[model samples]
Target: CPALGDVFCIAQCYRAEKSRTRRHLAEYTHVDAECPFISYDDLLDRIEDLIVDVVDRVLKHREAHLLDEVNPTFKQPKKPFKRMNYSDGVEWLKAHGIKNEETGKFYEFGEDIPELPGRKLSDKSSKLVILMLPPIISPTPGINTSTLMIREVIFDRCEKKERILPIR
Candidate 1:
């Protein structure tokens, strides 16, 4: 079960962080701060890679059943596995009114949706999309432990909303 609210919150946080980073870069450029020697392209590339890694770790953790048990609420029952094609998932999101701002498409799941070609992970098939949180501080500490804990938190949040709303 995936809680939509939590997922949405994580997505928002990721976007905000990205925005802040870009703003900081612009400020540094103006002030000529010795903000390292990384090029803008390099920074962007690193961010992309970091996002992918986080998503992968979260997905694996969820798949391993490491999440906490969620309290049953007004959640809808999980749907059976459908083995849908990648395009199908995108279409489904579009049908459900989820739009991607980048491609002007509706399949984007922010940090949760991986860059998979097809076969979108969905709660319908007991497949969850995990989005890892960025490191708390520079030189993030306890990478493994923190990631696992975050995964558990995300899992519990999602489980609570497994079937709360109908998917289009």
Candidate 2:
């Protein structure tokens, strides 16, 4: 098959997830893309571009009024989203005294940052910052799943909406 520059799918997807998290939905429109011969960095860049482009188009159309109603002060994110490595993020969490809920110990390297815990960490960072963490590969029993990190959008204090856009 000849290579295609970039292909994306935005479809109605369903998942039977047991946990209740803001990031989880029983059925939602899932947006995914595939690009042949692209490096990981290229993939990240493409994803950021797609998101920003979509938001820009929406804001330019009448749908933006609907968006504004939901988030009145919502604004299009600037380019070059902030990024962080997995090890560095773990250190940041430890430095801020965030402990794992399952194990009372501090979050260490190779530890999975679940949605709730990730939100807690995002709460401590600057408002509207994007945090990207590397994927975790585990060989232990009952922990073999590769969990993609969280993308938190936090509404900061004083009822002002601040967002954290994490992409990995």
Candidate 3:
């Protein structure tokens, strides 16, 4: 996997590509050069410098937004005030139209609720109900089985709302 710096470099490259102009040309070129030649030690140094520069710029910008010298006042309330437990979150989900097979327990839209009252499928059930559901064992040979399983799970989870079920 590429390191954080590499990812940042790639993003910077993309932005540079989008905003290609004479003034920004040098900055984009630097980012491109920074991408491929990143040896382990070079990457570490570049990442450290990047972190320091980012911190310095953030501190400077935030200082300008401070109401008092000692502390800065927040501009707006942060979203998602606090995290809720799984059960509480599930209850909220149920309130919002996701039906739990059981009366009180609420499962998210597409989340399989095997523990619910009317649910007959086991929690570990792997039966494919959706036709578009990719096979666990890939038709293409040589591709990793584990990779295929992961892909299948992701595809199913992503398409859960669209999946046709007997109850639905």
Q: Per model, state how many residue pairs clash.
A: 8, 0, 0
CA deviation > 4 Å runs, candidate 2: 101-104, 116-133, 138-168
Name the best candidate (by TM-score). Answer: 2
Error of 1 at 75 (Å): 13
In the range 27-139, model 1's lDDT, one tens digit per residue, is: 22111112244553353344345445654575467453433243222222222323333334555666766655567665543322333322233444453332223222313
RMSD after Cα superposition, model 2: 9.3
Model 1, 164: alpha-carbon shift in Å?
22
lDDT of 3 by residue, 1-168 (tens): 235333433333324254433233434433322244454345434434554565457566846555345445322212212222333334454555556645555565434333232122211123212112222234443343433422224432221112111111
Clashes in candidate 1: how many?
Answer: 8
Model 3 lDDT at residue 147: 32
lDDT of 2 by residue, 56-104 (tens): 8988897678986777856566667555555566788888888898899
How do the candidates rank by lDDT, highest first?
A: 2, 3, 1
**Each candidate: RMSD:** 18.4, 9.3, 16.8
**Residue 23 CA displacement from its true place in model 1, Å:** 25
